[model samples]
Target: AANDLLSKAKLDASPDKVTLVIDPLIDGVTGSQSVATHLEEKRVIELVKSSYPRFQVARFSAESVAKSPIVLIGTFTAINNAGAATGPRDAYRICLALADLKTRTIISKGVARALPDGIDPTPVAFFAESPVFAKDASTDAYIKSCQGTKVGDTIDQAYADRIVVASLINDGIEAYDAGHYRDALDVYQAALKTPGGEQLRVLNGIYLANYKLHHTKAAMDAFGKVIDYGLKSDKLAVKFLFKPGSTQFSTDRSVRAPYDAWLEKISERTAAKQGCLEIVGNTSATGLPAINDRLSGLRADYVKDRLEDNEHSLRGRLIATGKGSREMIVGTGKDDASDALDRRVEFKTAKCAI
Candidate 1:
């Protein structure tokens, strides 16, 4: 399947003038880099080198983009009705696009269907650790670039507009993964100064990096901005990991210990608006459905308590609810970091709260 796609993309750019850099493929629905997508990306890159040796594609690097460049961008979509006969495993629809950065046009496109082959859909380190629901305008734009049955006839506007900023964001992610929190903070700061940089990932990256560095003030400010962005979009999901099987936080001193500050910001921001809020708590699908439901409610009430504590005015304006495992983002049910996003507290604006 990879060979079939790469055969169409013109990876053979002039070696001296243009570099062929392959942007990492991402999950179409979630806009996350995953184990499956990473493996597929590796397979496709290898095919570009081994099967089509004549092509001049460079390994991705900061130096590669110094000259004029053409980029390979792609998405792997795992759907419920994958049409593959693998029992419960998901099949994938793969799309690969080649865009010329110099002309801002997608010159070639290819697609293939993937059979269910034990692909791991777990998100990568940075995405799994991120504290907020990631899907937003920027995510929607990127997802748009990867959609459609026929591409390459025109420029992929969403993907094209973001290639440059995406590079900086990737750098920041790498630095964060390597425990260079300060460096990651600086990189995201630099991205914030760029033209197309006010993205969810960029903003969330700033908040996470600051939180890790113990820069409480900066973290709170960035977090407030993240909530503002979410509020504008009308929903916000925050990952507030708790102690096992309980609404209480972990005993670990520093883990999720900033609840007070977090609630202060959440209250400060939400109270400034006219509408009430529905605080919904969700749990991973690890335990019995009944217990999970009750536990999720407890968690939501726990958050509500803290929020109302931070601001007395919110006592009646906020309501607590729970969905348990009914609505899951990851749905993996591993109950670890892999499914952490499943256990989140969401704040949705409400016209009236009872």
Candidate 2:
């Protein structure tokens, strides 16, 4: 694709002059015997001669080879060519070196898809192209640069959507883990407005931050988000946790109003995409044989029932389960209240047709 593009582009914008330089192939191959026996390979020399019948090529001199306007080096190592690595760094270094030797322009196949921001790599009409994804911001930048020249390449929309969703969820999880309830809420608010399965993960983080941390108003608002955004459809979407020996959350409700404001914004995106919510429950080991088991089960069920009450289609689609005293985020046993960190619930989007 690149070679074809370059060939057509160069014809319309011809340079003042173009020269060809060849690198010999590596190893004791067919040309090696001829080069050794005849002091020059007639067959290899003829191949170049026939390929470029119009252009004059310098014969048998390293100095003469270095003096050409354009040098042609093979993509791989060549024994007869006897050049160092033909990678991107090597190509750039070769160009810089040739610049010092009075070469005004360079034409090589070793150019990278993109160079760093400040380094001005001279444009030689050439072709090399690669795909870019949204998660890879660096590659996206490179693709954008290529598009500027080609007017044909465009960023993948689906990849961009996934990247935005994943980033928001990750940020929310980080904030909740750090014990910043309001901050976690803020992260989820930003995330919920985005699209994809990851938005459910962000909602799950918000639910745990509010319900397990004792932010009552925030918890209510988080629940409201589930209802308003129509996200209560995935089976493994929501989760919650609590302090040992008690059902109460671990946080204060000083920041509920701000959380509510954020929830309002997320509700707007739910109608745009037919999304479903899922809930996963977890618990910290802190109690007797039967109590913790039942608590974990009940906590998971509570989230399930809440979704049903919110008027989402519960026709055997919404799912819930208890992971009793397993999957500890923190090492503290069930008896420790400070282990309140371990008690939690997670909510997320499960699947969407779109």
Candidate 3:
């Protein structure tokens, strides 16, 4: 894939004076880094250094700002079989490009498709610890920037608008990954005040950082803002894991520990909106369709009951439904943490159900 991408880029035009800096690649769908993306970034860098020295490689840093380097950005998305059915095999498409940091205009871009034979989609440390689905306006902007961006055209306007804070956001993520929660919080809080820095990553980072610092009230407050952002977008999907063959919440600390905090925040945000809500449940591909449908419905009902119990305003405004394995984001059927998103319970605004 690296070779294919290189062949398409314009690095050979002036092998003597081309310099490119490597920006960390991200998963286009989630606008976050992953193990797979890191590996791909390294692979692309090594290939450029060893095979194509015409383009000098550089690191993305403060010291390198004067070099006025072309930044290489990358994104990948999973391509599943057509329709709602799972295909025999799944493929992934990776896109790489070098863009002028100042102009946000693409200089060169290439794409490659390959089978997910051994790719790891597990998110980086910060994202793995995130409790809710973080896809939002920022993520949509990132995805748009990755797909169909022409060589001379600028990237997505929304993403370009927030490009100035990308470096600080990366710093916060790195700090969080290194267990410097306080430092991460400082960076995120500072970024939140920057123009175009109020992206999902900044908001979610603030919540996670405060939560990690044991600032319960502050964490809840920050989390409430995150919830509000998500609810307003109508794309909130909390990860709710269940016990083996049952609708009970998982007893595992990783699963049950922050369950209440998430529920409470969701309840608080939803009640303030005073809108009809639908609690939709889904399962992984490991279970039978018939049985999974019934189980999913039961789980949705359980969440609906919990929400109603949490806030009185949600009593008759909630409805529960299930889709079994019908709508999967990652249809690996592994039924493990890798596919946990498939088993999520989502909250969507709906018309009041009498």
Candidate 4:
């Protein structure tokens, strides 16, 4: 199927450049998992690159997409065979689309099934008669055809290292979500040892895990790394839950008390590093947009004031902005624990004259 799509995309001339964009895969059960998406995307890129060696292929980025044709890969569904009692067994429905940026149209598109680990023929056959798996046979054939080359053999060691790091980070998050702070901390530390592991996600995991374990000094140090890396990657978001529709923080004593300590640590670290900071505020989608916008700004100002009060040097180095409910990490807007992540204060490094 992949080859068919490529053939249909008939190159009048060898593409000078091709960008591969793999959208995050949609898991049938768990919705969207970034780690899984990234891994799958890498796999798709490797496969496409191996198949189309004539074109110069690169990972899609905003800067690269404007000047090249893009091969967009997305997994529509991933279903795990519950009846299979043994090793990993899953099937994925994936879509491949080629878009010509110059022509502004999708040149070729096809859907292919992907079985990462082989599935049990017995269960597959049994389900084959069912409505869901009725089309499985043809899909499986397409999947086999789409296997351009063995991914493990084609991908570079550096890319493999990134996959390892991302996997560990995902494991850490799962552990953290399950309230296993010590385990999560160990996993995050392990990830940090691998190449390409010194990332925002890994550092943030380390900080959260340390904080949960009451390792104040270690958490502080991790937070410093988070700040440094976050500056470069622009991916860090500090949690600051507030009372409903007000600037006052939530009265969760454990979280509230430690937040002050975090501010002090951040202040000292920023001052020592001579870093200018931008305090950006966000809110849950629970209120009027105008009201939320105003309240978010006030919250950012409040954080800036607190930081300035903690470290006088920060007074002239801080700027505050509000995004209201525009950039929610969680968009449920339930006004509960689930929605808490939406209300956050992010610290971004700002450029300033020395």
Residue runs of model 3 more than 4 Å from their true location after superposition: 11-19, 54-56, 61-68, 81-89
lDDT of 2 at 339: 30
Q: Could you tell me how far off, in angstroms, the CA of residue 114 lies in candidate 1 after the best superposition?
A: 5.2
Write one digit per residue (lDDT tens) for candidate 2, span 1-354: 223222322221454434443332111111111112122223334654665443344432334434633322211111212233321222111100011112222221222222222322211110000000012232232232222222222323442334445445445554565566678677777766655543334544566667657877776665555444333332222212344455443344431223223323332333234444455566765566367667776776665665455444442444556676664443224233223334555445656433
TM-score ranking, best first? 3, 1, 4, 2
User: Candidate 4: lDDT of 348?
Assistant: 78
Flag the better candidate by lDDT, 1 or 3.
3
User: How far does residue 202 in candidate 1 sit from its true spot (Å)?
Assistant: 1.2
Candidate achieving the largest lDDT: 3
Q: What is the Cα root-mean-square deviation between model 4 and the actual structure? A: 15.4
Worst 10 residues of 2 by lDDT: 125-134
Ranking by lDDT: 3, 1, 4, 2
Best by TM-score: 3
After superposition, candidate 2 runs with Cα above 4 Å error: 1-278, 334-341, 348-354
**What's the lDDT for residue 196 in model 3?**
80
- Per-residue CA lDDT of candidate 3, range 76-174, in tens? 777663533456337777888777666657777788787788998778877766666756776676666667687787867776666557767888988
TM-score for every candidate vs. truth? 0.85, 0.30, 0.90, 0.55
lDDT of 2: 0.38
Single out the weakest 10-residue window by summed lDDT for candidate 3.
Answer: 80-89
Which run of 10 residues does model 1 get worst, by summed lDDT?
81-90
Residue pairs clashing in model 3 are: none
